[model samples]
Target: MDLREKERKTVEILRALKKVNYPGYSRDIVSFGFLKKIEVYDDDRVFIDLEISTQKEEVIEQIKEKVQEEIGKIGWIKGLELSVREREIFRRQKIPIKGKTVAIYSTKGGVGKSSIATQLAYTFSVLGLKSSLLDLDVYGPSIPKMTGTQDSEPTSYDGQHIIPVEKEGVRIMSLGYMAKGDTPVIWRGPLVIKAFRTLIFSTHWPDTDVLVIDLPPGSGDIQLSLAQEVNIDGIVMVTTPQDIALEDVRRGISMYRKLEVPILGIVENMSWFTCDSCGKKHFIFGKGGGELLSKVYNMELLGQIPFDYELLELADRGKIYVLEKKNSEVAQAFLSIAKKIIDLLKISV
Candidate 1:
């Protein structure tokens, strides 16, 4: 084929590469403006350069592999060269908070990830650190409700910057305020990403020592977006002591590893239950799943939060258990985990 024909074929091949699992975004690398340069030589050698906005090795590799595979389909293409340069756009949208940001994530839902995130942020505040919580669970934001701010809405001082709602010493921002009562957020991946960006960049947060983000369950767009946009100091994984949950926890750990985000430790929620009458601890959801997983991953077992009805009720009622149930075991567990996180990150309170 002639050089012009080869170049056209190369463009077609590049345009065929689509990002997998990034829902609502159907644009391929070529159309997404990520294909910075593509050169087709007379000797059937092809050179392609990509300007990706993510440092995630998995994402970058996926794009590179897809490009190579497409070009390889054209048997006459003897050589293929691919180069990816990280040019993250969201990194430039500075979060004005002077604090370390940590994200709490889970691979599966209904494992108390939000509860842990809310309590951890409150715990840090209780320890005299100026801490804030950002609920990135756009679809099911429970932080505003859990922090007793569900009835309140965030205000804007200059009609552009939003002032986060403060509740129990923890400043909070959540999409819950935007949604009507019990109405589901029917947004696509791109809209979700846009909302998250607005939440991070437009909110006016106080000078905080730690900012805890409650990421939605699963390693999907929200997780990928945060890793690409911000410099997360560390991430905490939340799981239950059950094989079903642990399976997803393994996946969560793998995702973070691929993203090169530091895993501070694991917090085993609903690890066990203690009988009120017998004063004996029961292995409610099996035992030691978090500890075993932590050992396998070489991460610290931050703490195991036992199952308690009172704690559950408190969470449901938008109450900080660490403050209300000061002398309870669950409260202490949260405090210990907060201290470990602070020490691990070496943040000055």
Candidate 2:
């Protein structure tokens, strides 16, 4: 292929990358390439020399895979190489208390943990509070997509620490931001725990009224690591209004009590489904699971958000419901829920 044709192919490859990669902090990927001297060869092979400061080897490998996939479509070029420098020793400072950190945990997955966490962070920001979201869901991160801040990665400060991603008003970070593609993360428990520690302690979280952590589902290693290392202010357990789900909530609350973290309250997602025609509500998942759990555990029932398809759609598309349909019942419900959360946190209005 001619030089011009090769350049065209490179552009096509990069455009293809825009479609395939997970939508989380693309700017970081761009800046990383810019800083690392990413070069495209005339034959279609690309070369990259990156110097990431983190000690996590998985991160380096992810970057390599993403870049190669972005360039692999066009032609077969010879050379592809990456050289990463490790700098894991982060400086420790006194804990600053501009805000509190709240982690959301469930005994299992699909409990809408990310939705609640992202909304809480946005609501705190909307109320003129500086809030940051730290996503510890390394295996499956959804914070970036929920906040509509994908393709905007965090930057490094002082050649060591990474700056948190800012969207609307909330600053955020996630393992999704560092992931390369749809590849399943098959990390061992120890490595996963270590990555969670790095995400919590290494990044420079700005001053805020709160920092919400979207912890991985269940009382697993990641949960244990966060509960032990970070001085969290509380834990908010999410569940649906189903008996099986409530059983999970019981275990989750038990774990938090064992860790001695205060229970903020319970948020029952999919509490009911709103009818489009009659404007009535239907409890498709039965009822009273959240209330019964709260009563049994002696914890307050923070709120019950009905199952609104629009809300789910907005979340799936990475747009906040409050922005899309403020007049909708879902929006009002979440606004009220946000207020209740603020009250529980004892944060200033």
Candidate 3:
């Protein structure tokens, strides 16, 4: 490559590196990324070095992987120097919110609430914060259907505690997995509550950083019971760009407020649809619902995901868009929203 091209590539790599935002510490793990040196040996080969200090080699490896990814942007780059130094990472005894609970619900169904929750949990796992998704939508458990893994029962770690099923990195617990695929979960209110409690307290969720609960829609008894039982860090209300859905969102937000759970933010899904043929944007649901709701409720409008055919295709195949296409516009939007959620929770790895 010519000098001009090399300089441009270097700039692009640096810009990409700046976009990585991950927590630097865990309970007993002090992890951070530091630049050691960089040497350009030739027109296409570059040696990048990193200094990672942590008791866990896994932690250092994580930093190294991130560095390599940034450096690889300048194609033909070769060789990596990763130096790991073990040091004391202060240990603190605190409640395990490594497994922090977050519930995603809407006043109405089909607002893409489950998709947002699934993507959020997947993003957390990708960013090195272990997370899980609990499908508490007893009436309609779609997480298993979306993610495509099923019938995998939670194993008992001690023959007494159940371990959640893992997928792509995020642990998952669902009624869909427990019951036969075709069989509907026909249960009473008390039975639903019991199942949910077992899913939460009984499951041996690995030292996870977050647990995103996909709740059933509306001001239902199950939703209220979930809010009452768990110490939820917050609730993420989902809605489309229509007054029909936003009206219910207002009620959902109010329910969370009454239950004393904070409203993390709002996700406006299917806010707009773009035509592939004409390359024109269309407000299929009639715009302005998200903005109005945000204004009235006093919460940041986290994101507005346009309706994309590819996203649905990927979701149907158990593929997370963010992981499948990291640099795509949709993936970038999800990552941005994930960062916002982390900031809201004041969470650190």
Candidate 4:
């Protein structure tokens, strides 16, 4: 109602609006310099001017609707006027990466997707190829801890481009680096999407031959957002041998199929457990789930990784077992998967 109060509320509104991210773009409206001006009056009236780069009427309307929706949440605002202008210069720009990107996804959690992603990156490095791993699990980023860079944060120059942290001969980026120790990222969908985009496009990734992204389990906003933005080469679906896990994998495969992105193959993680005492293999989860899915979908069964306690121990210590225990069966399985992926993509490694 008062002048100062109105100004404060107007500023708050702008901040909130800045947090709204367009699905396909890598930056929010504010970061893209689309939100041009805002004015607040003492009579609880507000006006906003937005300039977007796209010529599509639907996109412009969507932006307006989102703005109005956000503003409507503040009941104190009595009246509002909004204007959106289109400028070709304001359009989203794609950041070119000189590498094939492979997203490792699962429809459900607790499938060791992150561990497999980290190991695959390490495997690529071991075979003398440039590799990078990006942790796009916005709510549960683990690449920082998995790669022994948990105490570090990515460095940015000129406050725009970020320098990725390197470890074990692989470049790494993760939201975990941005958070304080063990603090959960309590972000909404829009914020999560924006952060994912920033991590993918804003970071200064090296000339990697392959960039493996560890996506959070599920077919949620992150997966959809990624489909819209990046030209992903292929997807490597990870699942346990249990029927429950395989069911989720089917949904994941269907989602990618609808998106028209290639499903590189399926990796059957924890396919079995080997007894140390008797040297016997046991199908703990089930048998041939990966093979079943691969056959049904006509995709290759990249590798079958048996369950191993030593692999878990190395991962717990933020180490890549592929490098330390290169001779181990689990490590060898990862290498085989990596080679198959490289071959599928036709990348020289």
Candidate with best TM-score? 1
Q: Could you tally the backbone clashes for each prediction?
A: 0, 5, 3, 0
Model 1 reaches what TM-score against the true structure? 0.74
TM-score of each prediction: 0.74, 0.70, 0.69, 0.72
lDDT of 2 by residue, 165-237 (tens): 8876778898778874677566977889777777876778756678888987887788776665667887887
Better of 2 and 4 by lDDT: 4
Give the clashing residue pairs of candidate 4, or none. Answer: none
**What 10-residue stretch in candidate 4 is worst by lDDT?**
87-96
Quick one: best lDDT, which candidate? 4
Better model by TM-score: candidate 2 vs candidate 3: 2
- Stretches > 4 Å off in candidate 1: 1-94, 245-247
Better of 3 and 4 by lDDT: 4
lDDT of 1 by residue, 123-209 (tens): 898899999999999988888778788998999979999898888778999999878588767677789999999998888885878
For residues 145-197, write the lDDT of model 4, one tens digit per residue: 77778987789887998898989689898888887567778788889989988
**Better TM-score candidate (1, 4):** 1
lDDT of each: 0.80, 0.71, 0.71, 0.82
Per-residue error (Å), model 4, residue 120: 0.2
